[model samples]
Target: MIFEMTTQVRVSNFDEGRKWYETLLNKKPDFIPHEGFVEFELIPGCWLQIAEGKPTEGNGPLRLGVSNIESERERLIKELKIDKFEINSRPEVPVKWGTFKDPWGNHLGFFEYLDKDEEKKSIKNNLERTFN
Candidate 1:
């Protein structure tokens, strides 16, 4: 059975890619496997890999969950100089989302659940299952 997972995004320049990912993630990478590769542990077992290479088209829109979509979007815009991407949702949708790309064209995005209580429950459950 699958227990852990990783998703990769590529960039043509190593130093620029590393710095861009650091700004986006708001932390230094958890691991640097070699000169041109790095890994961030997004959750307990989920990893995001950034590598030096030609970026592939249609590689992602690797969406991450956030606490507040609007605030996060604003923060990204001001801090990362990201374009003001539209936040989207539907009447029945439980979460709102927005997507943007890095300088190298690796698609990335963020989402926020409308129900904070449910989001907390999901986090607690996932942590328990992953750790216990």
Candidate 2:
């Protein structure tokens, strides 16, 4: 059974990519296994790896769950200088989301649950898994 997972994105330049990811995540990487590679443990067992290499065009919009999509989008615009993007949702959908691209053209985005109670439950579950 699969218990953990990782997703990777490539960048053409190592230093610039590392710095951009650090700013986007708002923290230094949890692990730098070697030069030109770094990893962030996004959730307890979920990892996001950024490596130095030729980036794959149109690879991903790796959506991260957030508590507030609007605020996070605003922060990205002001801090990372990303162009303004739209947040979308449907009546049956449980979350709202928005997407943007990094300097190296890697797609990244955020999603926020419409129901606050569900959001709290998810946060609590993740915390329990992290601490247990």
Candidate 3:
């Protein structure tokens, strides 16, 4: 039985949407084909794809629940060279979540998480990346 599959995000312009999703997602799209399209994983179960010259409708919200929201944000800011001005301050929303956007205008935000070891490591690494 297959446990993995990919979901493609459709859009009109590959470059335009690719930049948008990448900025919000904070990782490079896993694949690109010149004028064909660019792709990123929403997770192991889903993905976002952008193609050239095609019509794009709604921009989707890509939210993540993180162990340490501030650290994750800081990592993106420092490594990506995103200035402090580029980020939305913490607790952008109630219920324990901080919100922000990717370079292309997709909504990117992180929720507070407390049960994952990888998340803890990610937060620590991200914080270290940001500061030193």
Sort by lDDT, top down from the best: 2, 1, 3
| Candidate 2 clashing pairs, residues 3+ apart or interchain | none
* Candidate 3 collision pairs: 9-49, 12-54, 14-51, 20-104, 24-102
lDDT of 1 by residue, 53-115 (tens): 999998779999999889888888988898999999998999999999998888999999889
Instruction: Give the clash count for each candidate.
Output: 0, 0, 5
Residue 59, model 1: Cα distance from true site in angstroms: 1.7
Q: Cα lDDT of all candidates, in order? A: 0.91, 0.92, 0.59
Candidate 2 Cα errors over 4 Å, as ranges: none
Per-residue lDDT of candidate 3, residues 1-132 (tens digit): 554455454555566666655765777978775666777765554566666543433454546766567787787777555545333444443335655654444444676644466567776875665465
- Per-residue error for 82 in candidate 3, Å, reads 3.8
- For every candidate in turn, the CA RMSD to the true structure comes to 0.9, 1.1, 8.4
TM-score of 3: 0.49
lDDT of 2 by residue, 1-132 (tens): 677899999999999899888988999999999999999999889999999998889888999999999989888888888999899999999999888888888898999999999999999998997787
TM-score of 1: 0.96
Q: What TM-score would you give candidate 2 relative to the actual structure?
A: 0.95
Q: Candidate 1 — which pairs collide? A: none
